[model samples]
Target: MRSANPARHVSLPFPRAPRYGPEDQAAVRDLLHAGRLSDTSRGPAIAALEDAFADLTNTVYALSFASGTASLHGALRGVGAHPDAGVVTSPLTWISAILVAFHAGSFPVFADVEPGGVNLNPATIATAGQASAVLVTHTFGIPARMDALTAVTGVPIVEDCSHAHGARYASRPVGSWGAAGCFSLMERKPVSGGEGGVLTTNSRTVYERALTLGHHPHRLAAELTDPALRPLTSTGLGYKTRMPTVAAAIASVQLRRLADRMAASETNFARLLDVLHAHAAPITTPLVAAGSTRGWYGTPLIITEPVPNPAALFAACTAAGVPVRPLYEDWLSSPLLQDPALLHEAFPHVRHTGWRPPDPHALPNYQVARRQTLLLKVPDVPAADYMHQVGDTLATVLTQAIR
Candidate 1:
């Protein structure tokens, strides 16, 4: 029987957002005092945030959007994805990544992920047939093999950097590898603004197109070369997905503290890994490719062998007050992705040609890994005592489950 009070067993919540400090409070206060609560035009705060983020990612331009989905919508459109165009991507990612392609009038084709990793295998990309573009996700803060992926597929790549804010590949940042990188500043992200997103790009055309897709009509008009076309900007072609000034203000403050947060997370993650390895548990720690610096999204513990009853392990962990879950359990089998009726209602235009649901049998690696992976939430900066307790708890739970 499950305990009536789970709180008595667990010390902390499974996942908790970083607490805001005086800096965040001061930013909000300043925004309120200015009397400009909401402005369509890229206000001072928004512009400053874009500039700061662009500099951080080493990109020529950065555009803020209402949400990560909105940013991805603009990015897909900006990269020239059209109806019937095949966008090859990993099936192990969030549903939003696949949905963004459908929203952009592009069909998503599944690419198998690396055997033991959470990222798309570059080799499997070609199997998706003729791909117009590729959407690569640095899943769970581990950087994908961008250099290899780009070398193999000459098509444009849009990186989803939502989970990998401070991650790096081969000494370069994750966002810098793709044609345009999209990031989320949602509540759970490392550096959040409550709800906001940013897209970074080095290409002027991609930047202009993304701006036209999300920026206000007036902002779009100013960037237009032809004076006659400026008036047409008022037509409701744009998504009206510009990030609010208040959110931008909060994001700016968060961005400044990203380095410290990343450093702390890395240290804590290393300690946990050490503990897990020392115990010789039948689990695989997250694999970091050579020359890559992975930021911690969550601690992924891959079970070495399939348990007789996986639910029992989860139940035990929950009862013990340790929150754990599958990293992503067969996302391809989700009703949202497979239900033609639901998909048709959501994207009516794509029903005819662009909507092709992925075959679950096609991606063997994704199928195998999805079931074996379990996620553990680690604080950005955990105390030594807390981590030791967590590590000990995890080891004990696994041992009991196997026995």
Candidate 2:
């Protein structure tokens, strides 16, 4: 049985959407009235959005898609991994990170994550030795060690920036460091547009290939003529996964305010970390790499306890009204991956190339991750003193629960 209490709310209860305003509403209305919502090479609005994204990420080209998973699949195809070729990635990410490879007709080889809790370590990747390409996820907006990864794999690298929007490594933007970088604009990400995604790259060839692989017919206005790609574009079928005009508009508005939003979120996160530390929460907040500026999608903490029952702690927090949620809570227990019909239709090779959870007790990183975590939503435009209540609620709830 769950306790019912209003004074101890789990999180702030503001009704307004963050980072959205009159401008975003107006942009949506404009696209809605246009009635031509699909993305096309000639759509001026879409082109403008793409150009804006490219500039923001400091990349030569940016392509819009319906979701981050689509962007990842397109990137895999752009790098030319065949159906049977194994591509390496971390299992600790959202299942989509692995599913994207299977969708591209490639096998997703799992790698172990580091103590930092981002993606797999570069040294581990180097030793895997079977992967044809590496797809690294910046889990929870923490940048993976790109320098070490690039040095070890020496293969085309794709960065899953789904959790990292404004993150950087050694003064370089996350997307700028990889062969291709992908971002998500889902409801909970740094830039929320309901649902949308973008893929960026400096390589003209990779951009053109990803565009074709994503199944978008090039409009004359997009200026994407590559003699080498015409035939491939003609024969390939796309996933019909371009971002809707309205989603793009919403994303564009959020993108404009991303920097300020990130700054506030960082401040909120640091304050919360301090509170947790003061309470002796028995958890380690994520370590931001030197020379890296973090854009936290979710603030991750590691519980060093050998067998921390996060479910029990989460229940206790909820009973006290902290509005806490897990980052990827008990994902292995979900049935979607096991559903025969769904798996067969969406991932035919799942039995052979499917995802499997590591033995939690045996995995050093998983053991570290088993500690309780809470994700507090940082509104796009936060109230001046909201962090005070958030930090206080968390400290109170955690102090009572961390036995």
Q: Highest TM-score: which candidate?
A: 1
Clashes per prediction? Answer: 0, 9
lDDT of 1 by residue, 1-403 (tens): 2212212245644433446789998999999999886777767998999998898889898999999888888888778887756788898777888878888887788899888878889999887766778999998888999999999988899999988887889888888898899999998788789999999999877777777776777777666554544554665266688888888999999999888878777776677667767776688865777888876666567788676667787787767766575566566788877888887888787666755676898888887766667777777754565565566667777778876
lDDT of 2 by residue, 21-64 (tens): 79889988898898867865547666777887788779998988
TM-score of each model, paired residue for residue: 0.92, 0.86
List the candidate 1 regions with Cα displacement exceeding 4 Å. Answer: 1-18, 225-232
* Model 2 TM-score (2 dp): 0.86
Candidate 1: minimum summed lDDT over ten consecutive residues — where?
A: 1-10
Error of 2 at 263 (Å): 1.5
Off by over 4 Å in 2: 1-19, 218-224, 233-236, 304-307, 329-362, 372-374, 379-385
